[model samples]
Target chain A: MNWKPDKNKPICPQLCEHMSVLIASGEYNPHDKLPSVRDMAISAGVNPNTVQRAYETLEQQGLIYTMRGSGRFVAEDVSVSKQSVKTLRFEKTEEYFSQMEALGFSKDDTKNYVKEW
Target chain B: MSELLRCEKLTKCYGTKTALDEIDLCLESGKIIGLLGPNGSGKTTLIKLINGLLTPTSGSITVCSEKPGPKSRVNVAYLPDNSYLNNWMTVKKIVDYFKDFYEDFREDLAYEMFERLGITPETRLKSLSKGNKEKVCLILVMSRNAKLYVLDEPIAGVDPAARDYVISTIINNYNPDATVLISTHLISDIEQVLDEVVFINNGHIVLQKTVDQIREENGKSVDDLFREVFRW
Candidate 1:
C-alpha cells in the first residue's frame, strides 16, 4: 500500500501508524522480526531517529517487542495490537467526522455519504 | 550525544558586504542537520568558517571544543561545494592523499563504497563527469571517522535519479557518533533525512527546529514552510 501521510505529519508517528495498520492487516505475522531501524529508515527515505521513534511507539503500544542485543519483533499475540488498531481507526474516523461536521454535515448526512462511499 | 559543533555570534564579511551575520548555532553529535537557506544567504560562508577555509570576520566557531584549524581539521571532514582535488590525480591517488593526511580515514570503507558506486580507482578526476566528481568527494569525506562532517550543497547539481543514490550513500557510510551538517536551499529533496533544520535568511537565522517539531506544530512540511518563510 502507498505510504503517504499528510504532507507535513511527523514521519515517526506516521510510520508507527503504518506499521500498526500492517499488523492489523496481518502483513506482519506474530513473532516476525521487523526490519532494523536503520534499514527501515533507508527504505522509507527518512531519518533513522524517526524510525527509532516509530519503533519506540510500537513497543509502548505493545505492538512490538525487543530482544536485548537482537532486534524488534512483532508481539507473539497481536490481539492487543488488533484492539488498538480498532481504537486508532475510531480516532481517525472521529477526526474526519469532526471535520465534516464543521463543514455543516449532519450525522445522518454523513451516514448517507458513508453509504454512498 | 556530545556537542560536535558550536558557533557563537559567528559572522563573516567580504569587504563591505556581510556574508553571515551574528549566528549562534550549536549542533550535537549523531544528528543530520540541514543548514537551509536560499542562494547567498550565507550557507557556504558558515560552512567555510567551520571548515577553517575562511576566517570569520567576527565571532567564532568551534568543532569538538577547539577553534577550526589544524586541530579541528583532524576531527572534521569537509565536502566543499566545488571540486577541490587536482584534476590530474586519479581517484585512487586522492584516496591515498586523504589516508596520508587523516589518521581516521578508513581506506577499506572508501574502497568498498567505490566498488559499490562503480567508480574505478583508476579514473582520473578530469575524466569523471560532474556528478561522479561529487560522488567521489562524498566517498572521500565519508571515509573519515570524524566527529563532524560538513557538506556544502552536496546534491545541488544531482539529477533526481542520482539524488537518492547520493542520499543513501550518505546514510550508510557515516560513523554513528558523527554529526552531519549539510547546507542546501532545496528542502523537499532532503527533508526526510534531516533530524533538525536551521533556516537562514539574509545572513540571519530565522528558525532552528527538528523536522518532527516543525511538522507537529505547523502541520506543514518543511518545504511548504520554507516557501512561506522565504516567499517574496
Candidate 2:
C-alpha cells in the first residue's frame, strides 16, 4: 500500500493515487470520515475542486458516501476495493499479454517468463 | 420568473476593433450555459460586460431587472481567464477582501475549499505556482453564494487531470439555483454538464439552444456541432 508521488504525474491523479493507497493501507478505515474538502485541498496543494472531483469519483465507485452538510466517509465494505483492484489488474494483464503476443512471444514463453519471475 | 441575464444588441469595441457586435443573449436561472468561441472572438468581452468590469460601446445588458452595474456585480461571481488577485496578498488576506466585498461570501466555505486544495492561509499569492493560483481563485469565486457565476476559460491552461478536478469542483460547489455561464474552447469535457450551449464566432452568437434540443435536432453532441459551426 506504499505510495510515492511521481513528479511527472498531474496533481489530482497523484492525489487520487495517494488516497487509494491510504485506503488500501487501512489508514482510512471503512466508514471513517475523511478530512473536509477544503482541508484536504490545502494539504494536497491542489484546488479544492480537484479534491472534490476525486471524492465524487470515489463516491461513484462506491468506495465512499457523502452526507450533505456532514462529510464524506469510506464505504462500509471492501467489495468495491476488491472489485476495483481485480478489474484494474485484469485490464493491465490483458494489455500486457496482447503486447507480449504482438512481440512474437508464445504462451510457453509467457508461462516460462512468469515462472521465472 | 425573472431572467438572470439579458443582453440586447450588445456591442463592445476596442480602440479600433469591435470585440462583440450586436450580440443578443438571454439566460435563465438554474442552468449551466457554455459560451464557445475561438480566441479573440469576444467571449471574454461578453463575460466582462456581464460582470460590469467593462462597459459596452453601444447596447444594453441587464441582470435581474437592473443594468450591469455595482448592484448587479454584487450578485455575480466572476472568474477571469487570468489571475486577477493582487500579487502581494496572502490567501488569507484575499479571503478577507472577498468577505468585505461580497455579502454572501462564506469564510468557512473558503477555508474548506482551501483545505481541499492543500493551500494554507499563509500561502502568498505571488509564491503559488500558476496552477495553485488558479485553484485559489476558483475557491474564492465558488465560495460565494452569488446569483450568477461567470467563469471565463476556467480550465484553459491547466493539465487534463486538473481540468477534471476543476469541473468537479464547479459541480460540487455551485448553488443549484444560480446561473452559471462558462466560456471555454474545450467543449467536449464540459458539454455533458451544460444545460444550454451558446456558440459565438466573429463577435456574434451563431447558435443557442438547450443541450437536449441540440442533441435531438442536430443528432450530434454539442462538441460536434461546435466543431462543425466553428470549422474553418
Give the alpha carbon lDDT tens digit for every residue of B7-43 in model 1. 8999898999998899999999888999999998888
Give the clashing residue pairs of candidate 1, or none: none
Model 2 lDDT tens row, B1-232: 3489999999999989999999998998766788998888888888888878899899899987778898888889999989988999999999999999999999998999888888889888999989989989898998999889999999989988888778767766644468788999998777655667898988999988866567667767777878888788
- After superposition, the stretches of candidate 2 with alpha carbons farther than 4 Å from their true spots are A1-117
Q: Candidate 1's fnat?
A: 0.68
DockQ per candidate: 0.68, 0.04
The DockQ assigned to candidate 2 is: 0.04
lDDT of each: 0.87, 0.80
**Leading candidate by DockQ:** 1
Looking at every candidate separately, what fraction of the true A–B Cα contacts under 8 Å does it contain?
A: 0.68, 0.00
lDDT of 1 at B120: 84
